[model samples]
Target: MDLLEAIRKRRSVREYTGEPVDDAVLRELIEAAVQAPSAINQQPWTFVVIKDADRLAQISRKAKSHLLKASLSEPAHSFREMLNDPDFDIFYHAPALVVIAAADPTDWAVEDCALAAENLMLAAYAMDLGTCWIGFAQNWLATPEGKAELGIPATYAPIAPIVVGHPRRPPPPVPRKNPDILWIDAQTHCA
Candidate 1:
């Protein structure tokens, strides 16, 4: 698929099928993700591919628990609702959950990780896979139990979880912004 088309078609999918993603295809997606440019080519990122259903469910529950404790009252309510929903999973039933972890807090690793994540999401779309960026995992990883549960080390900061699977339904393309709103080259001269 064309790059622009993949970028345009990419959406934050919430619903996914239980279809299993092939190892080769998933590896290719991760390979594409790491191709993104990084500051000084640090490439300070690692990924944890969570495929176990039990672990995924636990993560979902603990994440909601941590969010509630952090005063995220709304999410707590949402979590309660999700628990009862048949489709509710930490990763929305995606077969794979790619947890992005960045090293070095002051080295601008977050930006690099974001670029990589965009690559992964777009690549997945091109390969007919769906992805949802789970930011809630970040705050959860900061909690004591979440750290032990996810096996994230102290040196690595949890960035985002890229949930990968087959989309249950095609999502509509998001609206684009006006290019003029971004002033790329505002000519100014000082005397």
Candidate 2:
């Protein structure tokens, strides 16, 4: 698919068909992710690909439990309510999860990881695959036990937990908000 087409078509797919993504396709997505630019060319990121169905289910359960015990701030009320649903799966039963981590806890770590994540999502869309960044798993995946279970290094920070799979159906195009642009000419700046 063309770059623009991929960008326009990419959406946060919550529902998946339970079909496992091919290993080669998953590798290509990760390759696309790493191709993303990083701060000062410091490609400080690590990726953990989880394909085990049992482990994915376990993660969903743990994340939901953690979310329920979290403080009920007004902004989080809706999310808390969603977690209350016993059948709600944070990953939406996606067959694969690509957990992107910051290799070092630098100031630009999160930003760097975000760029890679966007690349991965776009690449997946281009390949007729679906992806959703699971923010609810961030806190839980960073905990000691979470890290140990996932085998993430102590120095690495779990930045993006993206679930990947085949979409049950292609989502219709959604409208985009107008761009907020501010153009300043060089001549106007020198007062």
Candidate 3:
């Protein structure tokens, strides 16, 4: 699929078939992520692929608490539910969990990591796999339990945890808003 097609068709998938993602396919996705551009070529990113069901659940449990408190409406609320749902755990039993981490130094590392994640999501969609960018886990991942469960070093920080698998439900294209919000000119809008 073309980049535009992938960008337009990609959706934040929550429901996934209980299918295992092949290592080769996962590698392809990660390669796309690594190909993303970084600030000043500081490609400070690391990925942790979690496959064990028990560990995935442990991480989810740690994250669920924060999700419950998040100020979100309907689908987002359902997102939290899906995370806690017995059937939803393991991200619908998708074979892999990828934790995105960046070196904790550069000021632009967050943006770099986010771009990498977006690339990964788009790549997964092109490959016909479902992907979800999980942010609620930040707090949980920072805790002792999370660190121990995910096996993170003291220096590395988790940027996001993405779930990947074959999508069970077909996601419709997300509507686009006006692009006028982007100002290309150098003229300042505010004094």
Q: Each model's TM-score?
A: 0.86, 0.94, 0.82
Minimal lDDT window, size 10, model 3: 84-93
Please name the candidate that would achieve the greatest TM-score relative to the true structure: 2
Best by lDDT: 2
Q: Mind giving the per-residue lDDT tens digits that candidate 1 earns over 1-191?
A: 88888877789998888888988888898999999998998898888788887888778877766665665566456665554554556678788888777866747888999999999999999888899998666788756676667787776787878899999998887898867664445585555
For candidate 2, the C-alpha RMSD (Å) to the true structure equals 1.5
In candidate 3, which residue pairs get closer than 3 Å at backbone N, Cα or C atoms, i.e. clash?
A: none
What is the Cα-based TM-score of model 1? 0.86
What does candidate 3's lDDT look like per residue over 1-191, in tens digits? 89998887888887777778888888888999999999999998888898887877766665776566667677677676566565545344566888888866588888899999999999999888899887666767766677667777867778878999889887777778878776657675755
Task: By TM-score, rank the candidates, best first.
Answer: 2, 1, 3
Q: Model 1 Cα displacement at 117 (Å)?
A: 0.5
Cα misplacement distance, residue 158 of candidate 3 (Å): 0.3
Clashing pairs in 2: none
Taking the tens digit of each residue's C-alpha lDDT, what string does model 2 give over 92-134? Answer: 9999999999998877989999999999999999888999999
Kindly give the number of clashing pairs for every candidate: 0, 0, 0
Better of 2 and 3 by lDDT: 2
